[model samples]
Target: MSSRDPAPTVSADEGVPAAAGEPSSAAPVEPAPVDVPAPPEPHRSRAAARTWALPVGVGVLVAALFTLYSLAQWRAYVVKSWDLGIFTQLAQRYAALEAPVVHIKGPEYNLLGDHFHPLLVLLGPVYAAFPDAFTLLVVQNVLFGVAAAVVTWAAVPLLGRVVGALVGVAFGLSWGLQHAVDAQFHEIAFAVPLLAISLAAALRERWRTAAVAAALLVLVKEDLGLTTAVLGVVLAWRARRPALLWLTAWGVGGFLVATRVVLPLLNPDGEWAYGSRLDLVAALSDPVGLYDPAKGYTLWLLVVVTGAIALRSPFVLVAGPTLAWRFLSEESGYWAPTWHYSAVLLPVAYLAMLDGIDRARRGRVRWLRRYSRYAPVVGLTASLMLLPQLPLWQLTNPGLHFAGLRAQAARDAMAVVPDGAVVETDVGLMSYLVGRTDVYYLGNDNPVPEYLLIDRQGGGVPQEWGDVLQVAQILHPGVPFEVLHARDGYEVARPLED
Candidate 1:
């Protein structure tokens, strides 16, 4: 025991103990010193703890790079979509502990109606501290980084630290994740890391860890419940554990509860909004119609990036629900690999590759076992080749370092509008204004804001500063409105007092 720790009043050995005032009967006896051998377990544990430093270090490095890229894009006004603004507004409401009434979607539209993501509320405390759109962006970047780290850590035991680290680099530079970064912040940002942890645990047959992680996906987004069901199938089939069959029930039941019950109740229309959007019957009837070149390309890319070796593992089955819903959806964005749609697929692909390789190494097939050793090299090569065409390539360009005229114009327009003022806006300045001002999308259903903020280049309402007056006239005809700041397609206007 350390000197600071209190000593036991009595000796551990009964014979060695005696009252302080009362003398021991057998002469003066000295307590024998015990030589406790230092357990090798603790030393091994410390060494094992030291072993994980590589994965943690690698994840931090990759996350830092991603965070830098995301922040740079924000600084340069690289508005991919209005998603960043929408998520920011959701965070704002959650921070205030208010109902998620996002005006940017429509007048007091509870975003839960559009999509079920109570998990986004976790960002409430974060937004409470920073209260900016970039806060969400940063959180997403960090999650992606964490996913990469988990992937690396998983590979470490099977592939060793160096190859595992390489796998992480490939994951960081993968198309799905890079595209997610390009698409801006999304609710699925939470899913990427969770799935990574789940898939990694599945690789080692940690059923409890895998199922628990998959269970959480339903909260991140409603449809992930089906994804959880698929995970249960994988676990049941691979582990041969009948008890795990309950996950399928949990998943399907949760999806039903979230969609039919929770979503409709929270919805502004008192109905499930996206229930009818899936056209699976039409897709199945005319199989030719389901043949989207983009969809085909995304599917091919999923396996090819893993050297097509990931197909050997059943863990890839976890991705079936996500791909099924995407291809089956009527939304064109869902069919494409771009945007934030495919980020969930990347981790699955990499994990499948590792699982496939690890399993192959032990199999009877000689050629396959020999080939598995070189698979990581192939995956790394593919990722590097594709890096030039993806978003991370922006890091190599010296031109991306500085903010351009459009960014300056956005700042100028926002500066003219005072903080806390209600402003109706387009996607261009929506993210910029949502943090400090009340922002509503330019739509007839939403209430008229005190200030009209539009970008002639922003689309929907206006694309340039010069177009603000026309939008004001269209919305409020015969009501004189003063153009407050109109420059470089970013404009702000307020209705004149009578």
Candidate 2:
């Protein structure tokens, strides 16, 4: 077996190297296996980056566009009405350190009496800084519109990024757009955004953020605070321990601040009392109830019921609690049933509807799966068919069209009057216009003026207007009255001496 000199050649079977120049059947093989390092996981890191970035970018972009659109529309429509005058007068009053006492005119405008909402009073500072009503409108509209979009975006779960983005867009187009762009009511626009932020905070389990949002809600309208507090408690219970503690602290702090410092300061008169008139039962039972079916009751009810069910979702506990409170409280017009209230709930409702559809798809029940598949189609068809019939809904409300016409009439009537001349109006909006803060509001049982401007095209005379006219007839017995202008359900009457 030995073939070479120096060192004898080893046998291949022995696992030794053969001598140089001699070929062996088997070469030295690798040593017994040992541990080695693994390759880097770059793919996993890349996937995680994608998971978060997509949702965030989409959410921001959608919100920005929606807000811009609404603000532009508000700028166009707001100046055409006399609401600008009310805002302007109030701003001027605040600047002059004059705080007028708000009387109990009815459930609708009672909140106007005492400056109970310090948040609204902040408008004083805004007006003071800008001194331009149009500028203020643009800024407020843009801010709230963006808030609506962002909050709606936050409503969708990260798992359903597409649905979430759609929800933001849909809500902005629906409730947010209607109020911010069409009606241009500040209360509605602002509430929508606050509700959105509240939704986002609840989902994140950030107690401080939720509490702050709830606090802002209270500022918008008082009763919303109670609803928000109850929701906060529910969220805290779901989160447990440290989170609960923070939530409790926030709840307590907010309650104290709102009740002690803010409410008392703003509502000095404490005359914005709550009563049976504004009760939820009354709002529901009244023939002239706020929720008219022709306008959009099915959509509204669907939103409420679905949100309640969505509360049971394991993943949406935070949003669920807050939404539940909104649903339950909104039943009462006094609590939060105004058109603005809808803005807060729109995103939540959309989220709930999506959840219902998803649940139906995953259910064991065959009927449910079939129903879920057809539900969207059915809803869409119904909405389109019913949408054309919506104009009838506006007619049911006798006062809505009249109110718009009256505002227009007030603007035109004010154009001819001297700056300091007082013009009595059934409502206060006209007084605010034309820089005539001293005008006697026909409300509060005040007597009519020698001059009476009645906007006939506006609609049936307001009870207060009738009262003013009755007094004018008695006081100025044979005075000649001239009709200065007339159009669109409106007429202006001024007294002339023979």
Best by lDDT: 1
TM-score (all chains, Cα) for each model: 0.90, 0.58
Write the residue-wise lDDT of candidate 1 on 1-498 in tens digits: 899998775433655566688766755555467677986665777887787788878788878988888877878877877788889999999999999888888887888888888889999999999989998988998899899889998988989888889898789668999899889899999999989998898888888999899888888899999998998888888789988888889999989999999999988888888888887888799877887888998997887789778988998988999999899887888887789889999999999999999889998999999999888888888887888988878878837553455877788888999999998887877897899999888864556679998878644553332478888887777877888898887777889987
Off by over 4 Å in 1: 1-40, 43-45, 398-403, 459-466
**Candidate 2 per-residue lDDT over residues 370-434, each given as its tens digit:** 76655544433433444333322332443543234344555676565555554554433342332
> What overall lDDT goes with each candidate model?
0.85, 0.48
Query: Model 1 scores what on Cα lDDT?
Result: 0.85
For candidate 1, the TM-score is 0.90
